[model samples]
Target chain A: MDAALKKNDKQLTVAEKTLIDTNLLKRISNGDQDAFSELYINYQPRLIKYCSRILKNDVALAADIVDEAMIEIWRSAGSFSGRSQPSTWIHSIARFRLIGYLRKNKELLQDESSEWLNFKDDALLPDEEIVLSERNRDLIKNIGKLSDKHKEVIELVYFRELSIKEIALMLDISENTVKTRMFYARNHLKNILSSLDLTDFG
Target chain B: MNKKQLKKRIPIEALKLLPWYATGWLSPQERGYIQKVLSQYPDFRSLLDAERKMINVVREDKSILDKSCLDATEIRLNKVLEQLSSTNEKNKKASKGVNQGVLVYLSNLVSSCSPKMQYAVIAAVTTVTIALSFAFVAPLLDENNVYYPATSGVKKSNNNLTTLLVGLNIEPTDPRLLKILDENNAKIDAIPSKSGMHHLTLSVKLNATQIKSLLKTLRDNKALFWFAGEEF
Candidate 1:
């Protein structure tokens, strides 16, 4: 029995980890600060990573966004339904907060100051600098060659890590429409990436 | 079936299936079907390879937030909680003071009303004074203005001329029909009326027979209204 339990534990996936964290969220909902802290520790890194992509690497701004979203999570944790997975719920919260932050600081997101700051920070990383390195830039340039709808699906799915169902919800489109977009986006991306030298990342 | 037969069976747009295939979202049965098709056609295999590379590039792009920022976020959240608690405490004390003041004022005001009943006796005299003023002025108002219904008949003037006037509750966008002393014509005028209706007065030079023909035309167009006259 012990050996069987050890084998099952060793095979635990990301989804399993998320399910365990959600139980912690249930306790946090009842005003358990310790459970809330545990939930935060489990999910904060991924949430921050997601925010960084959306906010484009202003650590302070990303921190502020994560702070606001987590605080909202703390306040509204009692309202979480098990209808969706906990990660999905938390992701929705993060996306909502990020959009709110962008709306409030519309000028900052648009102006050269944010981009300039990100560009300056690019030199700090040596191995895994920014994902949009020169090779990725070439890939993006070729992706720009695709139709707008095709490019949108690729960005939302791969870059944002949104599931097809989530993408359908976000875009207010049908699941078939999301699938169709993904189908075209993948094909177009394939065509573009084929022309470039992407073997280095591989 | 041969590779050519398989290629012909699958639509070219099925090439769009490559992304879902790369994501491993395709069901086992569907994957087997695709594999069998690909096996017979080796040329499409390179497209599948390219699809795989694209997925890799997308997944490898890491999220921008790091651990230190999340720690800082926790500290900021605690500060917000502290501020909220302090504000609630301050509000509680302020509200207690406001409730006491309001209660004391209401009690004093309620007690003062009973003894002041003699001063309240003047209200009846004030009402009678208002009633007398209204009775004296009402007839003068009636003499200055005449009330006309939406539909009325034409009245003859003192000079034996027949006149028809149309009254509208709304401003009429259409032209008006008028007959005066055996002649028939229509005019659109901006004349105002006393009782919130738009008025048009028509004086006819023609006889009543011609006036009837003009009135028929106005009636067909749903524009005719009966005339109202007061001998001033």
Candidate 2:
């Protein structure tokens, strides 16, 4: 399995990977099943995380959403204009589907409000915190303390490793808004860490 | 001003972009600028390391989806793919329906024309169609005398080769079938993949009357030919 994965990776450059993805979409547009399967394996993990977050950690629901989004990809691949990165295009489709699901279930309203309410100041007790690396654990805890808007930018950049432009395009926000959110989220995370006596963590 | 002072001096914009820098998502120019800043303020290197560590920590929390969920997703994806295939086939059939609609539309348009104009248009279309057909068919017409399709008269040429799709009554390997075709100066050009059919090329440049005679000759041999018809 490891050898197969390494062969699959092939360690292509980012531009090469994007080019391959664009080519795959073109093939998918022509109803190529093998191309769709290759794209599915490449995107499943990240898409699961992205959709799971938006759907409030409902991994099963996120997988269903991912399936629906993949179906949309297969349907509309011919319409991909290649203006944006393929990753941006695919993530935008997943975001649109997830938002649509939330709106349909009337969960968007509750989700927005509950997102802030769900931020627990005490993410881990003192004893539980000792079980993990205090600095890494504190950083994760503090990141969770951020507002949904701010936390999204942080997650997109730090965890997903998306460019500012890509995240802006995916979220339908300006690049300035993405940067500003990251800025505020960073400061807010720092303050939260400082208050928790993890000031020197950074 | 020592290490603490230099660390404090790091730009807020640079700090805001540090996550992207650590993740290598920044452009070359932005990365260069960040690298310059980090070089000038060596103490800020710790912050960059911390950023990298922070990313690793966040990515380490892989509780989002398990293997079972992903396996289920693959099954669901296959279902979607099945639906997509059937949908595509339906779409192809619907597109054919659209083509048929276009033909109906053209027919209606033809009907809207005056009788004389319609006749003129039809005549023009028929002329063009026949001209195109002949133009395409002319290349296939070799030195061999070309036979038109069933119910059409044979076009005689110098070489009197007539191709016929003959259905055999007896087994193909039967000697009587070869004897009858050999008597008529016809040889099997190709044994068709379909059952009961063979392409016989008759080298006797026969005219319409002679072809009729040949047909009668084959019909007389009930043990050999079941059905025989000329094809181009």
Separate clash counts for every candidate: 14, 1
Per-residue lDDT for B83-170 in model 2, tens only?
A: 8889889999999999999789879978999999899878988899899878776655655545433322223433546766565656
Q: Which stretches of candidate 2 lie over 4 Å from their true place?
A: A1-12, A111-202, B1-73, B108-115, B119-232
List model 1 lDDT by residue over A1-202, tens digit each: 9998865664454346556767877887776777777666545544555565555343445555766787777766766666555666675566556644654555434433323322213322222222223243243223225556666777776666666667789989997888777764554343334334344211
Give per-residue CA lDDT, model 2, range A13-44, as digits (tens).
Answer: 44566688899999998889999987876665
Each candidate structure's TM-score, on Cα atoms with residue i matched to residue i, is 0.30, 0.35
Among incorrect, acceptable, medium and high, the docking class of model 1 is: incorrect
- Best DockQ goes to which candidate? 2
Query: How do the residues B39-65 of candidate 1 rate in per-residue lDDT, one tens digit apiece?
Result: 866756755775676677656742211
The DockQ figures for the candidates are: 0.04, 0.10
